[model samples]
Target: MAYLQQAPAWFLWLASLGALYVSAFLPRLLVYLTHCLRRPEDLRLRYGTWAVVTGPTSGIGRSVALELARRGLNLVLVDLDAANLHEVSGTIMSRHAVQTMAVVFDLSLVSTRKGDEALRRLRDAVKKLDVGILVNNAGIAKPGAVFLHEADVEAWVRMIRVNLWAVTEVTAAVLPGMLRRGRGAIVNMGSASSEGINSFPLHTMYSATKRYVAQFSRSLYVEYKSKGIDVQCQAPFFVSTTMASGFAAAWRSSALVPTADTYARAAVGWIGKGSPLCVPNLRHRLLGWYLAAVPGGVQDWFCLRENLRHRKMLRSARSPRASACRPHGHGIPSIE
Candidate 1:
């Protein structure tokens, strides 16, 4: 009592502020570390017997499908490419000995009745299964960076349709069943572009769409978490796939730029854990933590400069002079 009475006011204020900071940040840090230490549970028991993965033919989607199969869950593989979907289904079945079904539906056409029809088909395909997980992984970004006014209107619209609308529509279609079953998980693929304080200048629409996913996922989490549903939006950067090949050539294989398979192996362990908004890739999450320390304006400028450099390099590579330098047997890589 005597020591407390003699304590300095400034020291008490500082101690209070320190406690306030810890109260705000410590729980999240503990959750993240817990998610890191434990592997995801058995999907068949945790959610259900089946999991659906959209855009399952390639990239992270394909890897997620395979990883889910490895965990002994039947799969419903959805993609626009029927041939590719079939191949992925066959591979998963043969490798994991799990039943697999492929649903070919184009998410980019959601603005029209075409997308509606595709969703109908997807619903019908999964109507008989005990689907417990939906991975909204199908999304697209244009080839080269451009200002909003100069961008391809049709492509930009398609990007919005696929990245934003599809997520909403798909979740709506799938959520009722999850609610009925009393257990389910929805994993929306967001981007690190809008994670934390980073702002992508030239990639405006894509960033906006991802921001929508993050918000939607968090809101849905609050709404349905008590009903035995897990909705999460994971933001990852520079995944080494056809979609990101335009950003950096070395993205082919690097610790910072993980291949889809490698990223998925780590990401799957986080499926039904952590905050509704997640950065699944460990390296990318660490980078996000580092970037959080920098001033917001500086982060924006760095992203803007990087995007500009990438756009210039892409333009040069597509120019006639650079095209002529290619070897006879070589061809430009598909940027997806």
Candidate 2:
């Protein structure tokens, strides 16, 4: 204290600036640290007994469905591939003490006239169940990154349809039931390519769609939090999955890329937390903190370089399916 009183004015100002910087991120740091110690109310009890998870056959959706089931929520698994959906349902039923229903629906068709029957089927399926949780985890991207003008127009349309339209429609179908029950948790999947950086260069359309998800989740959160609905947008850096397999091996290393199951384990903990947005994986949150601190120009520059590198890697890849992004209908089936 005496030393501080004697300290020069300049030193004190510098110290104050440093303290402010540290304080800016301290709350986030604490939340990330106490996550393990904090025990949220049982989701099944707080929300309801049944949960609906879209794109539940693979990747983050599959893992999240399993995690929710472990916590005693019955699963309604939605997807386009009937075989895969049924297989996932059986896997969940056998591995965990939870009932499972497989709903085959094409997410990419949500915005078209043909989507009406599919949405009606999904609505009908969940109407009788106590649908307490909704995970809109299904999404897609164009096959590799390309300039907007260089790509076929349909590529952009498909991404918007599945990523944005599908999420919107599925939530609409599930929300009425939650409103009637007066409680639920809605988790919309997001991508770091959209939120963590300033601009995602080559994957423009894909990132733009995800940006819509983030806004949609935030708006719903404010609108429904008082009514007992918790809306959260959870974004992550690349996870090691078939969707990202086209990236360079070094960038996709296990240390940098979490597996889908690893991410899902962390995700379930934040279902009904106070925050409207989250990067559930601890590793991801740490990286996100650093990214947030960096200047936007620097981030955009590096993001462009990394995306371009991935594009070249995908083109040169020997595999027929070398794209980091999936082809149409290649997206994991989920609610539409």
Candidate 3:
């Protein structure tokens, strides 16, 4: 008691430091112990079964389909563009020699009644295959100013239908089989904008839809983790795809834009790891970290200014008779 009472300040400081060290290491030690006690399946490869990839005609979706085919997984490719669908499917079949099925349907057009019909068709088509992977990669976005005065409500509704509703519909169609099989993986293609941004003024509806996808994936993971299902929300930065060519050239220099193949490869790697959220590229990871750590008001101020500048650049790119920038020598296709 006397020794304790008379202990030097430096001695107390040293003791405190030792305690902190133990506290820091204890969690890791416990985790290691728990891991050792868990079943081998907990650490084994969870990918490589029958897979479905939406929007598998171009960009990231096509890349993912190719990568999965290379891994020896049979694929079901979904897309609205029948011509591109045929092109991509033919390429994958000839290159990989994997069994491939192509389905052409506008998921955005399927309502509750139509969704039932679509789901029935999808179910009937894949009923024979042991599907273990679902890539919800279909989405649409319209480029414009953010404010209601400039925003197109019809376009916003269409974007929401394609980006959000289709994900729900497809997942609902495939989840039951996965649950019964006791093993599966679902990867939802999200956007970096889902975390909320003050800088990009025109993506209000797009960002909101992406946020919904992220949240939905998280909730589904929590709900189905015990059933041997892994859900991953992949949020990637600007890619050199036609969809983002204008934005990439305006916001980030061409040197910084990642190609669709790069993003797809990284996303597959993350899926293999059973990661809950995959953010490709170090720059995007750092940006997410900083945005989450910064004060809301300060982030908003910076974001608003950046968004205004970005809007101006997009407007300039949209000038009549202006030539649309091409990436990878592929001219942008007219959707209309």
Candidate 4:
């Protein structure tokens, strides 16, 4: 009876501790659980399939291509780098003994009338194959501080062309066949910035393009998920590929930096499990959850502060000599 009477004080303290622990660890635990429950059977590929992987010359795209080839899928490797595309195709064919076709065209420029013609040619090339998978991984990021008047206008347009426009075009090109066959998988490579507008500084254009990807993926998932077409959007954080090595090295955090191969494996694994959106690294997954739970105003403030900090760091890193000697010519944005 005495113990019961005194229990309220102890119980309150224990409850407070429980709440704190949950606040800190529940999201991570849930993400881990979600991954655990996701089985390969939930998202299995039919044997002897054909897949089209864009930007297969390097980075995550190359890793994805190798993964698909290893899974016994015939591949159509698409990239602007003809030499690298041929080399990669040859390597995959010799190593995996899988049929591979190389399609060399700049997907980023596939917007003009000539670009449309090129897309038609590429489409025709793949039309003969039994393409069951479409991996829209081609993307580009411009190096700039912000989407302001100082930024290169053409660079912004090119970023949109590669990151957003190409994804839409390729997905549309592959849709009819997938719908007709009543079985296909489309994995769009989104980024962590898509969840929030101000996820990174100097990434304004890239972030906006990714936001489009996230929205498009959600809408398509709702419209076609029941039609036997699996549409997934993978929003991964920084991977230690050449594409992101500079950023990763500047930050120098291994836990936050996953390798391209690790990212590819987790992404492909989740695709096989039919996950609509996959964020691989545990820390990023938690950050995403926290960002989701927070208010929009708070997120905006956070982003603004982060941008200011990045700007300060960037200013400190630039030397007067290098700044004076920097080239004035406009350069095209490239994902690789």
Candidate 5:
């Protein structure tokens, strides 16, 4: 203290500026460290006996479901593919020694009262279980760049139905039970595209829907934090999974693009803590900070260029010449 008081004024001013700069990221760094150091919560004790995950057949959802099971929580796994859903549930049951229920229904089927029926079925299935954690992880993205006016009408609408409507309806269905019980956590899967980029031109609808998820989750958190519910919107840059397999080779896991399992483990630790909007990966958090410092026009140009490059690669892969060289009957399933 005596040494600090004797320090030159110029040095003190510089030290204060450095401290302020570092303070911006200190909280997030502490959160990451705390997650790593602490033992994870017993889901059964912290939330409830059963946790529900949508899109649990593959990718991030499957990883999170397995993690929850490992934490001793029974699962309600929802997916459109009955076979895949059963397969995932069976694996979790066998390895984790936890019970799992597979609910097979298409979230994008919003015609002829099908969407209503699907939600009713989902609500009924979940209501039977003491669901404590809900992960709204189901979403769809258009594969390439096409102007909104040029895109297929049916496919675009289907993206909206699955990405936005499913999240809202499923949350509505499960939230009442949580309110009555007075304890639960909700994790809404989002994307870094919602944060870093100025505009995701190729993935316009998907980006817009994710923005909605972030905003909705924040508002929900404000409304429910005192009521024993934790809501988080997690926006990750990338994960090496089937949904991201096309770009997997190009973008490997780091602190930025963590493997699905790694990300799931980290994400579960923040279930009932931190700000409502979370970018779980350290690299993504740093990147978001950097992007925010960039001028808006520069961010816009970068996003446009990056998405256009992705579009070119997708088009080339789907070209007739390229398709002829691939296996005769195999195709990447459209489910994810």
Candidate 6:
């Protein structure tokens, strides 16, 4: 009693703050445990049997399609790459014995006349099917990790179109069926650059578009929750996809970077569950928390430094004089 009464004002305030922080943290930790340990919702039963995955030819999109197929969901596989899309469709059908329909559509041109025709076709194809899951996973980051001034401005335009407009238009096309059926799940792929850190120096436009995705999903979740629709944004830090392979090699020597298949497995468990904004992988959750606690300026510094280094390596590889560096990475910028 005497010791407590004698506590200084600053000490009391600090103690109260610490207690409040823990009070909030514990419940969240419990929720995460429940989400991770619980049985995943059955897609075919809860949502419908048909899952539509954009950018389904590779990376996170491809893996998610396969996982859904494994769970006995037929798929509407969409991508700009005709050959790879067909191959993936065939693979899923053969291995999982699930049906797959591949659509070769360019998302970057979603607002154009050509995109209208493609989207109309997409709508017509899926309108009759039971599309319970929609993964808005098609995305691109062309001329990546360069300064705003140094990047090709058209590349930025294309990125915005693919990342933003495509997501919006596609959702619009699919939402009607979900509304009629009164059940569906929409998973929007996001990045930790937008969700965890306040700034992404070298990858400005990419992060901005992803930030939009996170907010878009959160808002849509709120809007559609009572309507029997699940809108979730999955913000991942880094996966072993070719998109992250170059810079991730320098970040923890890629030890922390999960493979697409590994991430996909974890991600599916989180679908239509928990907060609309979710960090799926356990490692990425830790990293996001750590990065969130760090000073914003420090985060800016580290992001800029690593991104700058990655950009330099990218340029060197492209330079005619530096022929030793490998030229292409498969599965990056799925739209282009």
Clashes of each: 0, 2, 3, 0, 0, 0
| 311 Cα displacement, candidate 2 (Å) | 1.7
Give the lDDT of residue 332 in candidate 2: 34
lDDT per residue (tens digit) for residues 1-336 in model 6: 799789999999988877876787678778888889987677789999898999988889899999988999999988888999879988998899788888888998888999899999899988999999999998886656677998777889899999998999999899999999999999999888788887988778888999999999999999999999999999998887767654523453466789999999998888988889998898888777656657899887887888788777767666666655445553222212
Model 3 agreement with the true structure over 1-336: per-residue lDDT tens digits: 799679999998988877876676567445534543444342124644689999988888889898888777889888877788889889998988688887776887767576567667787777777888999998876644455467667777778888998899889888888888888899999987765344444566777888899999989988998898889898876776767743433445555467788767666655634347667554555455446545778866765676577666656555654445434454443221
- Clashing residue pairs found in predicted model 2: 55-334, 79-333
TM-score of 2: 0.87
Kindly state the number of residue pairs that clash in model 2: 2
In order, what lDDT does every prediction score? 0.83, 0.84, 0.73, 0.73, 0.80, 0.85
Per-residue lDDT over 228-263 for candidate 4, one digit per residue giving the tens place of the 0 to 100 score: 777888887677776673242333267767777777
Give the distance in Å from residue 166's predicted Cα in candidate 4 to where it truly belongs.
0.6
Question: By the lDDT metric, which is better: model 5 or model 6?
Answer: 6
TM-score of each: 0.88, 0.87, 0.77, 0.81, 0.87, 0.89
Write the residue-wise lDDT of candidate 5 on 230-304 in tens digits.
999998877877666443233344545778898888788778767898877667777777676578898778667
- Give the RMSD in angstroms, all C-alphas superposed, for model 3: 7.3
Ranking by lDDT: 6, 2, 1, 5, 4, 3
Residue 335 in candidate 5, Cα distance off native in Å: 10
Better of 1 and 2 by TM-score: 1
Better of 2 and 3 by lDDT: 2
Question: What does candidate 2's lDDT look like per residue over 32-120, in tens digits?
Answer: 77875696569888999999998988888889999998898999998999999989988988999889988888888886666888888
Check candidate 4 and list the clashing pairs: none
TM-score winner between 2 and 5, please give it: 2
Ranking by TM-score: 6, 1, 2, 5, 4, 3
